[model samples]
Target chain A: MSVEAVTAENQAPPKPRRKLRNYLLDPQFQMKYVGMVVGVTFVVASVLGAFVYDFSTSLTDSMMANELLLDEYQGSASFQQIEERARAFDRFVLISIILGVLSLVVALGLTGIVVTHKVVGPAYKMRLLLSEIGEGRLSLRGRLRRGDELQSLFVSVEEMVDRLRAEREEQIDALDRAIAKLRAGDDRDQALASLEAMRDQMARSLE
Target chain B: MSVEAVTAENQAPPKPRRKLRNYLLDPQFQMKYVGMVVGVTFVVASVLGAFVYDFSTSLTDSMMANELLLDEYQGSASFQQIEERARAFDRFVLISIILGVLSLVVALGLTGIVVTHKVVGPAYKMRLLLSEIGEGRLSLRGRLRRGDELQSLFVSVEEMVDRLRAEREEQIDALDRAIAKLRAGDDRDQALASLEAMRDQMARSLE
Candidate 1:
């Protein structure tokens, strides 16, 4: 591979694995987004509702004027027909407003869930990994699927564990060497002094 | 109190404590319930949508028949007017159906959230508590707000912790006694034998 290509490949992050079942992962994180969507829908519903109301009102007024003019000529059938039309229109407007709001809310809720899943899935995994590490399971590593949020968090945690493991290994190696020296016929006083010094260094390293 | 009343009171389960922020405590547990509601709403919407279509179709057919008769008699004004009314009513029905579906979806989505909160809240708390315990903070307790779901889970975990603490305390006491016996001027062999016995018992208890 070309040097630039190799550098680019090395810089690229690991790909995330696919999840088995996509359930709602992070309800808490998605709640605010859902709220915002619902709020916008509510506003839209209100505006549309007002428009429907105004349109129906104008239709009603026009129908009433037609009915009033027809009354002078004794056209009862036309008047009744106009009245029925106006009532039907009014009912239509009401239904439109209700359905519009409902559909909006459901759509928003589902969208929020999918979006939040990206965040919550990773969070749940991190929590489990952290718990294992906290229990002194230094072998445990953080891993997240592709498209998961908090990539930086995974990197930071892994780096922290790497440092801790390195320090612990070094301290253990020094202690082991000190004991081996004492056992291999070093002067008792000098060996004891060296072991004590090693102990202090171990303590300082831990700190 | 009357005997029957007293008996009834004694048999009744304890009331859940009241909480200040009395909303969305358990989302995880409520997931199935929310799904059911959404499913039912979808069915209802479908049925209502069909009804609206059928009703509007019938209305349109009647208006068409009337218009055909009026057209034959050269009553163009009446025919045009009837056609307009039918069109208006058709639009009204369409709007009503749309609004009905939208409103239902929104309402059901919001309801599902409230129900799910009751479950998700408690589940989240348990995760945190488990993490703490895994980190060796066994003294920490699992607590949920009033009226939260998974009350049994909290109780079970607390009992488990209680048993573990008791066992640990007993083991510590035994070790302390054994150490004290070894340090004090007891017969060396007898002290060692007793200490060994205590160690075996401690091991058995832990097992």
Candidate 2:
């Protein structure tokens, strides 16, 4: 195989397609917010729906009274027409209530997921990076996506890692000078070896 | 003064009552999420309101037609009754529309703030703590609140800080041993001073 082909094969695998669950990177955090929004919507819808139902029922009762009065006048045509309009109004109210609640739930649920994702995504990434740092892996290869929330926090973490790396590098350099200085003295090999080991350990931490 | 009185004076100030603006610790981040939620609600409400308005108008027209037919029958009492019902229906539609929109906005907007605050609060605190670490202040005195989002991430950060603190302590201990071993050697004053300075610097970082 050509060198370029071999290098391509050795590279990191392509990211997998995001599944539905992928959007909920932190379900515990995301769901709490989603529940809050959806709950509020439900309460508001219920209260308003009740008011509308009461108004609609009273209106329908009054219209029925008029229908009876017209019946006495032998106005069959007007009675049928008014009855049709009443049925249409009832139908409109029923359909509206059902459709309105459904639309609100769907719209708000999707919006909650999207909005919470912005915060959870960066936090999830940062937690992974932090655990790596805890294990002495000072090399921060991953970065938060653009437009992610917590950009400032991520930048601060990056600066912290950079500062740590620089300090380790300085320690290694100091060990190098100390080892060189002790080389000419008798039985200095033990001290030199110890310093070298420390330097190597510090250098490995940056990898 | 008694020691207890002096200690009380030296203690941190009492937390002030949270103001309206205090909830918006990170306005830029919080508002974007709030805007997305409110915008979706507005679009849904607008579409639904339009549908309701059209249905109401058509229903009103049909009722008016019925009203004129009753008028021709010389039924003044029935006419007035029908007219009053029609006016009442119109008023209900108008009030419902106005009230529905207002309630949805208020409820959703408050939920947005509270939900987003859970995420933003921890992120803001972490940024402050991370910057302190970058400046060699390894002491992490702040903590996330109960019910806050990003609790796992906050724990991971605490672990990272603890690990870093331990590593610095180890480095200082090694320096102590090195300085003690060199104390009896000929012309070891320079080496001892250098090691002591390094140890002090490492110790200070954990302060």
Candidate 3:
């Protein structure tokens, strides 16, 4: 095979890899992250709840004491003033209790939601993706839940896979054609040249 | 195409839809299943906790009532007996409270572990698998968690795919040979016969 023929075959355009569908990163551990959150929530809520419980007890006692004083000293103050002050104290405890309870509930719910979405939700999604890959759907692309590191990682891997598959396919195709021409009894020189060129191309593409 | 060639090609293996890798059922959704369990666990634990709180209140009241009776009926009962009964009641309450508290703690822990394994663990694993898939590892078999329908499903799909890919490669090779022979003009009749056989095989395999 002429050197020119060899060079021409070697220079055949590389085929783009099939966009690889990545199934990397099990995403199963998101459950652990979620578990951590649940654990933390319980701890935090317990601590905060204990504080609220203590504060409520103290406030109730203090208000009751103030009530006793107000009743005993009512004659010294205007009725309106005494009543207004008592009302204000009552309102404070009531509001504090309400706020504390509401905050605790809100925090708990948010923690649950955050944990579920961040961990549980992704797990379910990963299962879906793995199944897709298992089904021989190599063309699948992983879409991360949001613009996060995880998502970036998946996307980047998928992109790399695609490049690799494309390159591989190109070499395989070139090898196939070279083999076919050689099999068809093209002049021995030309076929040999093509074979050498295809091999070089395959190696380079692999690299 | 000769009858012999047609028969040879037609004898090729069958094909399948959606290659399965293992015996897992919906292997892709295993993580989802785990997440669901975790979600259910959290919900159940919260509910149980609420019940525990209510039970604690009722139990405390009952203990208090018993205490009051002990005090009020002191004259009827011997001092020692009264003390003994009070102690008994105290022990009962203490035990019940301990059990209730223990249950809560245990339930919380289990929920964490379950959520961690199912939701978090799978996500990371899936990410890795996907990454590998993305890296052009077409032969990657999604690892199946043990003793689940998902694993079975994965296996089933993988098997199907393997069979089909093998069949396709075989057909491609035969087709190439037939075409090559036809082009060489040495055995056009035989090549044509082989082509017909391969076509038949392809049809049967797809079915």
Best by the lDDT measure: 2
lDDT of 3 by residue, A1-207 (tens): 999888879897767543211222223333344445455545644554454345444444444444445445444555566457646645654554455444434443444444444433333454465454334343445566662223433554466446544644554454455445645656545644554554344333223
TM-score of 2: 0.79
Off by over 4 Å in 1: A1-22, A25-36, A63-77, A187-207, B1-207
- Select the stronger candidate by lDDT from 1 and 2: 2
The DockQ figures for the candidates are: 0.04, 0.29, 0.05
Judged by TM-score, which candidate is best?
Answer: 2
Error of 2 at B110 (Å): 1.2
lDDT of 1 by residue, B1-207 (tens): 899889888886757755423444543334444565556556655564666456555646655664555456555666667777777777786777677567756665665566456546665676666544443344546478886644554554465445544544543454444334434635545544543454354333222
- What is the TM-score, restricted to chain A, for candidate 3? 0.48
| Order of quality (lDDT) | 2, 1, 3
Ordered from best to worst TM-score, the candidate numbers read 2, 1, 3
User: Where is the poorest 10-residue window by lDDT in model 1 chain B?
Assistant: B198-207
Candidate 2 residue lDDT tens string, A1-207: 999888889997768867657789888778888888988887887777667666665666566665656667875657667677777767778778777977887899888887778788888899889888766667687888887888888998999888876776666566545645554465465664565466355434423
- Say which docking band candidate 1 falls in: incorrect
Superposition TM-score, candidate 1 onto the true structure: 0.43
TM per candidate: 0.43, 0.79, 0.38
Task: State the C-alpha lDDT per candidate.
Answer: 0.55, 0.74, 0.46
